[model samples]
Target: MKDLIKESISDLKKSDGFVYVTAEGEKIDLHEAAAKGIAVTPVNPKSEVIKKLEAAGLDLTDSKFLNDLNELISLLSGSGSTKGKSGKRRTFSDSEKSKIVEEWKKVEAAGKKTKAAFAREIGVGYQTFINWLRD
Candidate 1:
């Protein structure tokens, strides 16, 4: 998975606005969304997510949306508004996963922290963050 991200994502062969991820892996299907470089789900135009995104002056679509979602989720968790911090594992929606991936990229591009640092900052295990990126 890391190889795919490092290679396929780096290649970014865009065909008709869609990137073709050709990394070879048993679970990496070229037809799947990940293999096509669609790392995030698009929010409905009228959905609350879109509204919040617009209110926050963020793009209503694409990576920006995913990043904002992660930011919001992180803020909620830190503010004690979400119970996801409980010892039990919390299931994240597809959208949430997308958000996490975007946020991970954002932090990584900043070049100030390692993967472990990011996990600690987000109150999650290092492997968990890597798993999120893997998915």
Candidate 2:
């Protein structure tokens, strides 16, 4: 199983088009983002935030209100935003990636459990780990 897993990881690393590319429209850092991967998407005009902004009729032309509205959204979005303190997504370094793979191996050797369980136990989202492994 370990050998198969190693081979699978190797194959995943070698055979990637895109994994973590789905994102709502925001162009601020798209230059940097493209190197990671480009996703096909529109600005999601029907999203909850958009609906609220439209219903409230807040003038988004005002920069001050944008920040205020953002804060309000964060407050409403509950606590699933555990990626970073400031609500930004987290990135892993090469050394961190190596450490995570080692830990994954150790866990796999310890017993038979689902990857989702391992992810929940370790506090890393399963999809996020899979995305990193692909990259």
Candidate 3:
């Protein structure tokens, strides 16, 4: 029975998508696995064997399960736009702002055309430059 179960688990790992079998021999799909909060891989963790193991009362807190769950959560949540404290809102000094504005005027006078192009050259967003002009 143990060997059979192990073989089933191995088969489950090899199969595609999230699969969970209820103790009563019912199959669970990806949507069901997600709804049940089962630890599944980020790239479709469903499998028939998984469903069977789950139905057989698989340990949800198993180390491998937790690790996979954490990885999936991280992948789903994204890496975030900000990078630590350095990405926090910044307060530009008056001199820096003036310098930027002056550079922007030179670009404008030089017929750089697109505001976005000039903004890119100066390493700032076009909207940011517009906001500076408004200030």
Candidate 4:
């Protein structure tokens, strides 16, 4: 079982394909994989081997490898968490954030007159003004 787990991890490291096996074969738990910077997919949770691995030394509460594991799982299974296809959310860059803030300032200046009128003057939706204010 241990060998199978090792093999599965090794294979995942080398390939983009999923490691499919019988329910009784060695499996790595999604939590363990996540901790180890490996992504475990939904298919992994169903493998009895993964359950067994979870019974071993791996700790699910560990956060270090969760992201990598999730990414690996997504890469294999073609499904991902709500964050998107990468199994994680992509945040705006510093430059993008700064630009948004600058744009917001301009929008706010125009909004001082009236939301609807300012939106029309800027050729933007009224909701854009609201969104900028929230940001």
Which one wins on TM-score?
1
In order of appearance, the predictions have TM-scores of 0.35, 0.32, 0.34, 0.21
Candidate 4 least-lDDT 10 residues: 78-87
Model 1, 1-135: lDDT tens digits are 345334433434322343333334122333576556744433222343344445656565778567656668777776323334556866678898788779989888988878887777766778888888887
Candidate 3 lDDT score at position 49? 47
Please tell me which model should have the higher TM-score, number 1 or number 3.
1
Task: For candidate 1, give the lDDT of residue 70.
Answer: 68
The runs of at least 3 residues in candidate 3 whose Cα sits more than 4 Å from the true structure, single-residue gaps closed, are 1-86
Which lDDT value does model 2 have at 52?
46
Tens digits of per-residue lDDT for model 3 on 26-99?
55565776798764433333344455566777655488876666566655675222223243556678899899
Candidate 1 positional error at 70, Å = 27
Residues 1-40, model 4: lDDT tens digits:
5686785466657443454333455455545666777544
Sort by TM-score, top down from the best = 1, 3, 2, 4
Model 1 collision count: 0
Runs in model 2 deviating more than 4 A are 1-86
- Superposed Cα deviation of residue 20, candidate 4 (Å): 1.8
Instruction: Please give the CA lDDT of all the candidate structures.
Output: 0.59, 0.57, 0.62, 0.54
- In candidate 1, position 133 carries an lDDT of 86
